[model samples]
Target: MNPLHVDLGVTGSVLDVVRAPAGVLSTPSPPVDPTAPEVVQLAADLVATMRVSPGCVGLAAPQVGVAAQVFCVDVSAHPKTRTSHGTFVLCNAEVVEASRNERAREGCMSVPDLTGDVKRATRLVVRGRVPLTGAEVTVTTDAFEARALQHEIDHCAGLLFLDRVAGAHALHQRQTYL
Candidate 1:
């Protein structure tokens, strides 16, 4: 475990909802260059933050103010998923293939306590390099895993779950953490 500090700067501020550029909603930016140190560090930071978050399974770089194509997800390491497969740290991940067959509720740290329902791919195949060794790997996520990956990827592009909510009125009120 490469130790890291999960630093979420100035929590509780409202996050901006990034809209898809005129022609880029359907096509996302390419993954980060795995050889880059910035990408590696962002992955580390993401892991650090997720480890400390309650029920958090994944995170993206842009959510941390780095617009690079890096993110970290570790569903297995979470004690909540003791019977699950395990944890992983991905850098420069790209969603190669996905099936748009479901819609589910989603939320984000950037967006604070507001939660909303959004449509998403039920399954996804993400290809990227392992942050620890820079080796190439492809991970196929389903169910919650798929949703988590999608949520993080959206962050990389400056998009947030609240932007995709079908019913704006259903959006939850942001509550105080303490």
Candidate 2:
């Protein structure tokens, strides 16, 4: 164990992603105990699912049918990423600070069919506990990493990109998958 990070045992098997129209996807998720065995398993599942989901850079516990405040994100491979941190899983994440707003097209694994224009902070400082170690860590990041973090954090709060779209006109059906 890294002392500051819990060994959540990352797996590669894909888990079925829960879609919209499911009540859980829209309901607020409760915080999980950082050290709980179930939470540890969830952290693993989240990473696995995100790895297998196409065009996915992030995922939330609620997206997987678990109403818990946990999310996994990896923007390192994304071409748009400017400050990559590889992959990170955070439990009960809080956006302690945010600045510099920018508008961009956003999509979610849970809302796979629809994409929308959303305004998000270009820089962010997030605080959360490492589930396995119960270690509190703060991340300061910008660009694509920051956007991914905000999107996943929104999932923890039961909000989706759809809710953040500028207008109904801002929403669009995704035309490309690549």
Candidate 3:
């Protein structure tokens, strides 16, 4: 079964996105019960927020001021995307496998002014639970979808692209938003 094709079965309201330097963004989020009512709602909320935000492919619970290991991702429409899993939410996600590190520019809604060159795995396998069903699933992907998954996972771990940059020289001022 395609784990990415999830039906949250609940309406979600868009929540305010928290900015960088906010304690929640820096503080590690705790693993959540995937099937719990609140976790399911939070998963839906993350998806809703990501959809409403232009150029956003993923969103984590911490970005919405929730300190929980939950996130949603969708990269189907991105020009850089090679393999997409569509939209999906996961709880307690972790990278089970990764390889082929490549440096690429990354931006965050939490830190709107800067983009950083961070090395991330181009191929990845992530393991996590589906939010509504608590079904454990493994996602194997490459290219932009892999990068998007890693970015959201980092947010769950209290790290930003800034934390992954090689140095200040690798950072660039954002002139425009995609």
Candidate 4:
């Protein structure tokens, strides 16, 4: 199901993406209270911003300058997407299980202009609570969706794709990344 449909009726401006030097990107995000009205609004804002950005499947709150465990992901129209769960938002996400490591090219909104090869789990099960309802959610999948989840989870942990690159040779600078 597409969780992006959650509209809090509060208008939220698209937040600017924070870059490398910004402490927001490097600092570990604090867990958001599931029942807080503000966090619910933030989740809606995340979905709104992600929808307007081209070629972006996922966005972490840190990428948008918020140091909290909030993120939105949607693999809907991407050609590489397999087993996509559509758009969804999760607060206070935790990776419960991960297996099957695979190296693949990755890009980030926070670290633009560079796409690096990072090894990530091909299969993952991530658990989190919805911001407004406090309901627990479990996402289990593989392929591009799995990669997207891992990427956002990394952001919550204050790690960038560069941190996972296997030495300087594995990194690449490019104009675009998917």
Which residue pairs in model 3 clash with each other?
none
Model 4: how far residue 8 lies from native, Å: 3.8
RMSD of 3: 1.2
Q: Tell me model 4's lDDT, rounded to 2 decimals.
A: 0.85
Where model 4 places Cα greater than 4 Å from the true spot, the runs are 1-9, 176-178
Q: Write the per-residue lDDT of candidate 3 for residues 1-178, one digit (tens) a residue.
A: 6866779999999999999899999989999999999998998888889999999999999999999999999999999999998999989999999999999999999999999999999999999999989999999999999999999999999999999998999999988736
Q: Every model's Cα RMSD, please?
A: 6.7, 1.9, 1.2, 2.3
Question: What does candidate 4 score on TM?
Answer: 0.92
Question: What's the C-alpha lDDT at position 85 in model 4?
Answer: 83
**Candidate 1: worst-modelled 10 consecutive residues by lDDT:** 2-11
A best-first ranking of the candidates according to their TM-score comes to 3, 2, 4, 1
Best by lDDT: 3
What is the C-alpha lDDT profile of model 1 across 1-178, one tens digit per residue?
3222222232322233233332333334466666565555656566667777776677666665556677767666544332222455666667899996677566666666588878888778887676545778877767777777778777666567866787777587756667
Clashing residue pairs, backbone N/CA/C < 3 A, model 2:
none
The list of candidate 2 runs beyond 4 A from truth reads 1-6, 10-13
Error of 4 at 49 (Å): 1.1
Best by TM-score: 3
Candidates in order, TM-scores: namely 0.71, 0.93, 0.97, 0.92
